[model samples]
Target: MDFGILGTLEARAEGRRLSIGGRRAQLAMAALLLRPGRVVPVDQLMAVLWEDWPPASARTQVSIVMSGLRRTFRAAGSESEIIETRDAGYRLRSERVRIDTLTAERRVTEARRAMREGRTVEAARGLRAALALWRGPVLGGLDVPGFAAPIRRWEELRWRMAEELAEAELALGHHHEQIGDLTSLVAEAPYNERVRALLMTALARAGRQADALAVYRDGRRVLDEELGLEPGRALRELHAAILRDDPAVGGPDGPARPAPGIRPAQLPQAVASFTGRRAEMDALDSLPPDRDRGSDRHLAICAITGVAGVGKTGLALHWAHRAATQFPDGQLYADLRGSRGEAGGDGPASANVVLQRFLRALGVATADIPDDPEEQAAMYRSLLQGRRMLVVLDDADSAAQVRPLLPGSHACCVVVTSRAPLEELIAHAGARPLPLAPLSRDAASELLRRVAGDALASASPAEIDHLAEHCGRLPLALRTAAARLAARPRPAGDGLPAPRHEASVEALEACGCG
Candidate 1:
């Protein structure tokens, strides 16, 4: 027979639940399950059944309950050897029964091992499986007097593990999807730092930087007003990173120092035909002053975002090239692959892995780079301190993925590009958002002329407008249409062109934009 005490005290024969008895009998089985394979002394049973006082007939009542429990076990199809009778009291035959508390504890151990090995998905699954065993509060209906402490401790363990499962989900880049659940978790556990931090991280990753900071504010107030303590270092640092519009840049491992004084010029060559975004560039030149907390609109780092092919990276590169002369410290850039699941052609680059490269770019020796992502961020931020450098984090995946790359202080500017807005930078790091919209028709036509050269010059303005229409007025699409027009041979003998679906514009665009 399988018995469960993590919730209601019940037994199952062949996986079907069975109610064994009322309060007195449940107390007997639970007492045995609590210390399976050992004898539960009769006096202790009397103490639990009758708190602070026991009647003269306590022994007789205990004997009757024990007899009833044996009958219930026998009726549940257990072998006659399930419970043993001893002169002192009784011993539960552990080998003959299954206990859910024991089962769940085993799963917890396995999950912990999986987590230690960085198998977070497996760990999360295991934790969820383990937590699923509890149907309700441990020993809900049959609360024995003097049994509160152990039950409370066990409940605490379940909650902690539940929070851990949420953290694992966050680590896997399910930032936007987990917001609702995480918000509920935080509400249920306001003082729980893990839940609060995870909630903030989820919000920040989902382009709700303001909400993320507000969560911290609320959590901080709760901690201060209730616990009389300040927010921990991790939460405070996260708050600070948001204020900088910088990627936090933490990873799985620790520190390393690469070759010293090695300023990396990692910026990609700017697009020669890059055009427009004049207003955005002007806005970048002027920024708002720092506000209270870490919310600074005039970002030391700026994030450029828009839909796919809207030219986020191209804009950042064009502006970076223009401002390159001012940054004597040097420029560094990485295609973070934040949006389309890949920064380049490859898969998304985790923050820890990218921080390793950034550390090397700053001239620190490889041996000195920390294996931990946070340590690398600290060193990277230190090297960029007071240096007029430009860091381009392109195609980022999430805010946590970028936080380590952000410098803690000033004198360096970073330009980040993504298909979707990264609101964390704007909310906390004083990042200026330069959202790129579709180019105007005039701009689109100009871009096409510049890209296709004389091939497009022969076409009438009406034809060009048709082509632009087919190109969706997006720079990437327009360039593609221009390239296609350039490749096709002009009508032989100059026959009048027949109207078509503009087959050259297949909605196919380049692998990247800005």
Candidate 2:
């Protein structure tokens, strides 16, 4: 079955259009197509068909709609059954279904590769083909509430693809040809600073410098009035360039981008007062071995899992810094925010966003970055080919979240930290599992001494042991307690500071020692 959800909720098999049922049927079909091959529960279909207040007969209605859809497909003489009825839900078989949206995604992925390899013309054509897949708004003419979010997302992707096309045109010196289309895009998404920049570039390159300046002024007005904002730095810089008639403003060579062969050094600072994880450090050090496995080798992955405040990030950072010399192409790091176990914190990092950042660091132009996650991952892997780089993903939530950010080169090594074991990675991706336990009492005491210095010099062994035990020998809690003790000097009348158990408890609470 050929599914068409990019424009309308329709399906065809063997060049024959299947006559699907009414709005409820369209709603159910759209839901199934959105998640091809995944079983969508009956309740979910009902919810999509009838939003919040699904009637008691909703189940029967859904069954009827599903039956109608299946009968239509059967009449179309599809060789393989497209829809399968699971125990609790219905699923569209991926092998039997070819979605236009997914095909577009694949096309975008190929286009990104072509662009990276300096095939600007082929890249432009591929991007245009992908954008053309969207006949109109997704599920055009559908007013179902369930369709709103996906439509908005697809529309945003379409605009981003257009922006990429504009960039490719500018790179190929088709600036005169792109001015009209870019102007239309600017009118549609006035707040899109990227489109604004592209339009200005096209106009200036086409010998319409005054007109390009006018476009920037119009964008500035729209942004200020509607969003209470000025144009972004890129736009402001482009405007300034046009004002000075800079020759580099819109040359066929295009704007300044990260040059090829430029190495990116993006690793964060290692823990300065880091302490104790000798066994774990040695295991991490073994990830990038000296053995030669020919040209094509698997990427080395190491996952460090442990309870909160068990120093997972500390161990990963310390080891990455130590192994920095092994990866000359540079290191990549991202706090996945997976362990943001607090009342209010940033959400888990998206693999696509991380890939975009990595690509930028590796010298890919920001305007040229693809919006599709698969495309981003493909481009990232292409960039890492034959290069020795270290990728550190900190506080990952799950294996699924970490998978896309991984490079597809044996020369690169990845280290991930998470509270969960991420068994999926270890089981499938051959990631070495390094489960971190809390520090021993001796290590905890030493860490305190290292952090506290003279603050714990006057303290007795018994007192230090008691404090370490009280903090469960967790490095974070121990460091917090020691740092707090050092900062607040409390003399115990005998030329020594008191190692109060109550103060240690307060420190543990402050750090949320789990």
Candidate 3:
């Protein structure tokens, strides 16, 4: 038989739900389930069944309920009695019974172990799985006085697990994603300082400094108005940190330390013959503020999104090279391989692995890097503190994958290129969105002239326009088309042959342009 007390009290045997009994009988069964395989005295059961007072017939009523429970179990196909008869009371046999509360508790234990070990992703996943088993309040619809303590304990456990999950996600730089849940948690637990701190940190990280401070104020008011107490030391300190623009709000260990005179020029080579996007480049150039403090715009991060091969990386690199002199500390770049078919593996690149590589580039000793992604991220942010650097994340998969890679300093600017718009990063991380479309007609013609050269010299403007149209005005396609035109021989003054779709597509695919 499978029994569930995590939500409503329920039992199933032989693929059938067993109608154990009504109020009095359910109270008896709940008492037994609570102490499975243990003997409860007859007097104790009588007291639980009648919180007010027990009559002279209390013992007889208890016996009747026990008998009814045994008959119910037997009818459910149990060869032996589920409740054992003892001189004192009865013991619910646990040998063949499955209890959801026990299973959830075991899962919670495993999740806690994962959390202590700094395996945050695993911890979050495990915690979510454990919480999924809870259908509702433990023993819902059962108002027996005996269940009050156990119900409170289980509900508290659920909230504790939720708090741990929020911490893990925050460490992973999922501040944007955690804001909603954390807000709800804070509302539910008005006096829970930890939950309040978590919500405040998430707001701060997502570039909502004012809002973060407001949350602290609200918490303080709630405490003072309701309990006549001021905010705790931790909450007060967090408020001060947010006010001073301290980057250590949610970071682990402590404030990150700036790297020692390390200047890393990690940008990949700028695309040869790169053309167009002057307005886009200008917008990117203005991302970093002239002062140490950031402007109203979040944290000096810009997400450049476009269709594949639409020159997102080309525009980013071109601008990076031009603005290299602005960032004195250095430039750091990584290709997140947002698309699945790229190098490394079948899935998007791991943020931990990416952080490790970045740490090495920023002058961190290989052996000194922490094994935990959370610690590594903290170290990375700390190392970049107060430095004016430029970070380029190319072809990023998602915001979660990009959050850990963000430097803690406002002086440091990040430019992300991806096929996806990374809306979460834009909305939550305060990233300036610079979406790239296909090049303008004139820009496309100019690119073709620059790349195809003599191959397109005899080709008329209309023909060049046609060729650009055939390539969808995408830079990668235009480049490949230019290469094709440059290779093929044609008579002088002859317009370029209309490009065939199949041959051009095959060549583009063969070269892995996307």
Candidate 4:
């Protein structure tokens, strides 16, 4: 039996071909393809099917779809097990299948690494090969909410990879060849400043300096007229460098220096003030120490997991920031993209990738790190065996997604933030979970004081209470409201507009809350 997901859905067995009919089956197939070999939880599948509001028969409908997909696979003359039902949900066995999406991703990652290492020619070849695997959008005929997030993410990655490939080609002195493709891309995505910058560089490299300057001017005009924002710093600098005929701008040697550090930009925009969770934070800090000195029995692994935008991350970060001094070695932060539509975008970071990054942060050289993921993870654990490092794994998708990255010794503490409560992490890894609740009335008022400043201090106690109640007592919503109030002009003679409790009430009511 042969399973091919690189293009259209095709499973071949013996001498016959199987037909998968209906849009639902196709969508089911697409979802399975996204994860390939992992079990997509039943609840998550239901959410995908109904998107925040599953009908009473949603579970039954999902089972029916799975059964239909199985029959379709069998009818295609394949005795292969395409889908397997588990205790939680279902898994698609893709061991022998040729999945184009996986292939494309693999190629693109390889090309990106090669390009980073100055192997432009190899990068271009690998990227071109990867691009060739994409015939069209994945499961084009299917329109399911479950598929939309992953599909959109995949499409965006595809375009990013394509842009990288074009840049690689230009670096390889194929500027003449890249002109047409870059032109088309620029037309299609005029607001993509990165693409425009690349086009200008390509034009300049191909001896069209005047055209390159025109490209920059045109891009700047478009941005100012349509978006009313200046070009990004990088684009503006590139334009200036081109105008001055700076050799370093389009030279084969690339930029003269690397950026200062590899750290992700600090969370610049302030999150809404945290409300409630003080007891939860205290409980997290009070977890029992490990008993075994030679083994990891004492230090607790505390996991904060909940639904998206439910303040799991907010609570974890707030607590971690406050408790930074406890873990004197360092405070490590990673956005694992565990839950989509929650924090970061889709496509959670792999455990190996996270481990590699963490190890590097701990002063391990890139070359010193082992190539095998298992070895890398082991090395990471070994490094953290006796250290008191505070590691925050934010937005984790699953237990398996984070298992390998765990610190071996109990001396170190790990705070994980996830959308789903990882019961197994608690049972198996001795992880303590701190469930977060919405803010209390007093806590909400204090948060408003922090955000609204003196203006909130003068507001009537009754109005403040009404405002907090209206904001659903959720920290994020309350902060937004407070910020709104702070931005408004101060009232005359110490008098303010009447508190619009009904407006806040209506907002919460729309969200199905009090």
Candidate 5:
């Protein structure tokens, strides 16, 4: 079935436009589409329709609307088969439904790949195609409450894509052709320095040098008048270059020009809600600063070892993001799963595979990578010999798996996160062992409040501590227990939110933990 929620809320089953009736029908459809292949509770559906003031007959009304939607689909020959009524609520059975926003995001991913491969023109074209999916205001006129957030997010993504496309176009001297479009964009986002910078560059490239300088003056005045600040470093540098007519400003050999530097910024996106690990972050930051050991041997290696669910990888990633500026070249990451727990899923990644990836990130050709493991390790170290870089080896099951991948150069910093303490890596390689433990009592409480809303706000301080103890102060376990307590239905006839103590008790009893 073709789903067209990007603009109008419409679905086509078997090539025919299935007619949807009224506002209630649209709301119901929107709710289902928000989470396809899952049941949306009837009460949750009622809340979405009439938030704070639900009628006494709200349940009956929800039933009526659902029945009407089923009849509408059945008449269209889609037959209520697509919408199944589960014990909790209604479920949309179609997993094959196509959503336009998902399509656009996939295209954005493709464009990112093109940029990585030095295909900026193709990246620009791909971005334009992705932005072309929107017909008008997304989810327009539906009035689906809480739907605005996702729409706003998508619109933000579209604007970012446009900015990226403009960047690529300007790099390829598509500046003259895009000045008009950019002018309108600058008017809309008056304070966006990037847009203004590109516009100035475009004007300068078009031989309107005076206009380009004037743009910088106008932008400076606007920033002082409104934001009480100056244009940022990039914009300021561009202005200086335009004034001096530096050949590099809008030249084909401008900024972001590919170089042979082996900066491997491959660290995965950091966890947004990473709670607390201040001491560990500081320890990793202070990686035993290189001393004059009478030799140039000073590679700072921090091995973060902990039990399962102790958040070793999470801490490593969060700190890596904070410490990214220190390693300007790049941050390389790999999951070296050693010690096969079974026949699959736990085996260590071979050193050759990891070196191949590292070598490529360092701009080495495939044919140039050495075949022997020792040779690969030697070449990897040689490339990183004099450069400052950060390498993260995560989930390493054993020491042997990590030995061959360590850089011999002291200029780099390597962070290894593992469950077992790789004693050999420490004894032989001088890795600083930072043993991570479960979250403390206070931090665990903060995490519970973060996950389960303000349930812990008015509860007894003692109660919060007791709940944390019940979960052994483990973040994963506390989150699970808090989730159940939060989902409990409020007590009958009490309008105000109830205390979490009773809910926690109920959760404990139901858990049946020995």
Candidate 6:
């Protein structure tokens, strides 16, 4: 028997399926599927089923629905006590059942890790295996209350995985092979800057730089007419790079250049002693693909908004590194300098300037790009309308800054890291808001171990715990502290107290005040 919750809700036994009966039961299953193996309170379940108001016999109805689901699982040959009643409410025992969602996630995660390690062949294989698991729109047959969020989330993941798979192919130099899929993706998400960017890259790589530049122009028009926004910095830079034929910027012939002001999404190799954030890592990993399939001009944006040093960039980069393969055309990252700058004119790079650079990277000529910010944006978007790419915009100050940079289509996915909550993006643009918090106690400790190694292993567990707490479990703070310790001249054999533990603790405590 197989129980799949990755894409859609399904229970099948030897090719035969078990029915969920009604929308209520389906909704219950969907809710459980959203957070498998975790106990969901009955009240929460009721809210999911009825939205605002529950019927008088909500509890009794829930019990009855759960009982039916349990029976269905049994009849479907799932003998591992699929659902168990708990003091809190109910917990689903998913052991021994084949869950497509879990399987897909595992496959994609493995692929991401492989790509990080430079194991391109293995990453490609893993991505293909993961993509093969999708049957249809996840939970396609089920219509239930509270299903929208999970469903959309799953679909987003699916597309993201597909994008990664395509990227892996691109890394293997399979540009022409990906053209078909890229075409469809571009058609579906016409406004996705990343997608258009990738398409341009692919075209350039396939010996069609002219076609690539043309794609950017088309995308530019769409953005101007529809959303009144311009292409982002990455796209513009790509165009310029292409025009200059800059081999250093990951263009056709030169050494692969890293995006300007863009650091790797993952921790630097210099800071190996990192710890905690398994859940955050998982959440980052679990972030669904862009979920705008209906409109060709769909723009899927995920804004990681939080306070300073909460590890927004860390989480974003980690996931981006893992997901780089999905955007085979290329991975583009930019730091908007939203957080750091002085009063002088030498402030963080502007959106228009960034766009210009991105366009060059994709093969746009400098002269072809206009001087006016609006025209530059339009030209930049036109260059990126039909590709599969991942664009990370870090430290955005406001939606206005980000709005102009959003791609004109959904063929690409954009991850924006910001300190403030972008309500307009979420409410108006369907951008999912992922609020990053501090690491959990365990995650914080693990981070410390990764960084400091056995040096801190023998230290008092309580003290270590206090230390993690003192850092507020923020990845940046923890990293900074760990870096300071690692830089010490003392040998590892020396039994030295963790330097600046008290000071670090005090600083962390102060962070809480803000």
Residue 18 in candidate 1, Cα distance off native in Å: 2.3
Residues 1-514, candidate 2: write the lDDT tens digits: 6889888777777777777878778888888877877999999898898899999999998888988888888888876678899978999888767899888888998988777555667889999999988877788877677767877888888887899989888876778889899989988888888998898998887778889999999999998998899888999998998898665564343543456567777778887688778888889878994547776567799999998889998998888888898998899999888966443676686677678778878877555666566887899999998889999999999999999988888889999999899999999999999999889878888888898777778778888887887778988898888887778776654223354555577898898762
Angstrom error at residue 348, model 5: 15
Q: Could you give candidate 1's per-residue lDDT for residues 1-514 as a string of tens digits? A: 8888888787898887787777777787888888888898898888888877889999999989888878876787776668887757888888888888888888999987666544567888999999899899898887765678778878998987888787666666666667898899889889888788878777776667788889999999999999999999998988886666434422212112134456678888887687777888787665322324343423377778888887787888888888777777788889877654443454567776677677767765343554455676788788876566778899877666677788764667777877667787678776777788888888888888898776766677887777776666788877776776667767644421433434343434342331
* Model 3 TM-score, 2 decimals: 0.50
Residue 96 CA displacement from its true place in model 2, Å: 46
Q: Per-residue error at 179 for model 4, in Å?
A: 28
Candidate 2, after superposition: displacement of residue 147 in Å? Answer: 37
C-alpha local distance difference test of each model = 0.74, 0.83, 0.82, 0.72, 0.75, 0.72
Q: What TM-score against the true fold does each predicted structure earn?
A: 0.49, 0.56, 0.50, 0.49, 0.50, 0.50
Candidate 5 lDDT score at position 169:
79
Full-model lDDT, candidate 6? 0.72
Q: Which pairs clash in model 5?
A: 263-329, 263-330, 264-330, 264-331, 265-331, 298-410
Worst-scoring 10-residue span by lDDT in model 5: 250-259
> Worst 10-residue stretch by lDDT in candidate 2?
492-501
RMSD in Å for all candidates: 21.0, 11.1, 19.8, 14.7, 13.0, 21.6
Candidates 4 and 5, the one with greater lDDT: 5
264-358 per-residue lDDT for model 4 (tens digits): 32221324556677688788767535434556266568888665445777877777777666766666778878765453464777677677677
Ranking by lDDT: 2, 3, 5, 1, 4, 6
Residue range with the least summed lDDT across 10 consecutive positions in model 1: 249-258
Location of the lowest summed lDDT over 10 successive residues in candidate 6: 262-271
lDDT, candidate 3, at 241: 80
